[model samples]
Target: MNEQLVLRVLGMDCAACEQRLAYAVRRVEGVRYAVADHGTGVLEVHLMPGTDREAVAARVVEAGFTVTGVETR
Candidate 1:
């Protein structure tokens, strides 16, 4: 089964920002889905086994967002 990573990403206050962050995150290896909600500043990423959470967080930063919190399940 895939792992789900819930992240609190800042600066995604608009649809564009949300889309940009999702795009960047989806480019990361092992990510199956990257969904961001600007209203909630939440980014939910479902990834394959062995996917690196840090790498996904890095991509969020690269996309000009800040990850303030993270939880995995």
Candidate 2:
């Protein structure tokens, strides 16, 4: 039941931004892994079953970035 969450994030300007966001997202309770790519403005996350998507988005926002879109599969 694991889910893959694809997020479009804004305001990331460099590799440091990607690393910072990946760290923040991976700390969320249900996240298995997170990879942020500033070049494409995308954050890909693997989450445990039943993880709340809103909660994940909140964590990203808290990390000082904007989550412009979210796709779950």
Candidate 3:
């Protein structure tokens, strides 16, 4: 089964921010897909096996965004 990570990210004020953050998240090794909505401040990622959720979150932080909450399913 696949895993999904839902995060509440902060400081994304525009579409460009969404693109930038989405790009960064997509670069993480086990990420299959990623989308960020600045309007909702929500970032959703589909991850494959061997993916570390924390690592994904770290990538988000490294991209100049703040991750305030996280959920998995």
Candidate 4:
């Protein structure tokens, strides 16, 4: 029951911003992997079953960015 979460992140201006956000997202519980692209302002995350989406978004925000939107698939 793993899931993929696609998030549109704001305020990402460079590769460093992407890396920081990706690292933060990966630290959240149940996150299997995360990748953030500065060019697209998107973060794609692979999460384990039952991962809390809000918590993930919060983590992204805490990492110094904004989560504009989220989609689960």
Winning candidate number (lDDT):
3
At residue 7, give the lDDT of candidate 4: 98
Instruction: Kindly list the per-residue Cα lDDT of model 3 for residues 1-73, writing each as its tens digit.
Output: 6799999999999999999999999999989999999999999999998799988999999999999999987
Q: Sum up the clashes in candidate 2.
A: 0
lDDT of 4 by residue, 3-73 (tens): 99999999999999988999999999999999999999999999999989899999988998988899988
Off by over 4 Å in 3: none
lDDT of 4: 0.93
Clashing pairs in 2: none
Error of 4 at 1 (Å): 3.4
Question: Candidate 1 residues 11-61, lDDT tens each?
Answer: 987999988999999999999999999999999999999998889999999
Local accuracy by lDDT, each model: 0.94, 0.94, 0.95, 0.93
TM-score of each: 0.97, 0.95, 0.96, 0.96
* Backbone collisions counted per model: 0, 0, 0, 0
Give all candidate RMSDs, comma-separated.
Answer: 0.5, 0.8, 0.7, 0.7
User: Mind giving the per-residue lDDT tens digits that candidate 2 earns over 1-73?
Assistant: 7899999999999999999999999988999999999999999999999888888899999999999998987
Rank order (by lDDT, best first): 3, 1, 2, 4
Pairs of residues at least 3 apart in sequence or in different chains that clash in candidate 1? none
| Candidate with the larger lDDT of 1 and 3 | 3
